[model samples]
Target: MTQVTIYTQNNCPPCTFVKNYLTAHHIAFEERNIANPTYRNEMIAHDAFATPFILLNDEPMYQVDMDKLNQTLGL
Candidate 1:
């Protein structure tokens, strides 16, 4: 199965929006709080400088472009 991971921070509207959107679409994803120290290295290693950084099948997606996401998911 393909894995999706979202790197996000607390109180970020876009992050919440994306999470809700994914859930509404019945897509399962792993949520990582960038505020957490445990994920700091992972975030840096992936070069994610912003919140709501999404990874689809291990590929980095810096911005949440809905159209692109839909196309990727064949939705």
Candidate 2:
């Protein structure tokens, strides 16, 4: 199974959208909210300075990147 991790923040619409999209597709994922210092630092280390940073098997996406998301998840 593919491993998906999402770095998100509180009260972010795009973050919610991405989470919902993944859920709707039944794509299991690990959500790391940036509210925690560790997760925030991790996101920055990965060069993701925004909310809804997604990682699929360690590959990073800074935004929704619908094409890449669909292709990666085989949706």
Per-prediction count of colliding residue pairs?
Answer: 0, 0
- 5 Cα displacement, candidate 2 (Å): 0.2
Best by lDDT: 2
Q: Each model's C-alpha lDDT?
A: 0.86, 0.93
lDDT of 1: 0.86
Candidate 1 contains a number of clashing pairs equal to 0
lDDT string, candidate 1, 1-75, tens digits: 558899989999999999999899898889999888877568778888898888888888988888978877766
User: lDDT score, residue 32, model 1?
Assistant: 93
List of clashing residue pairs for candidate 2:
none
Which 10 successive residues of model 2 have the least lDDT summed?
Answer: 59-68
Angstrom error of the Cα, residue 19, model 2: value is 0.5
Position 68, candidate 1: lDDT: 77
lDDT of 2 by residue, 1-38 (tens): 88999999999999999999999999999999999999
The numbered model that scores best in TM-score is 2
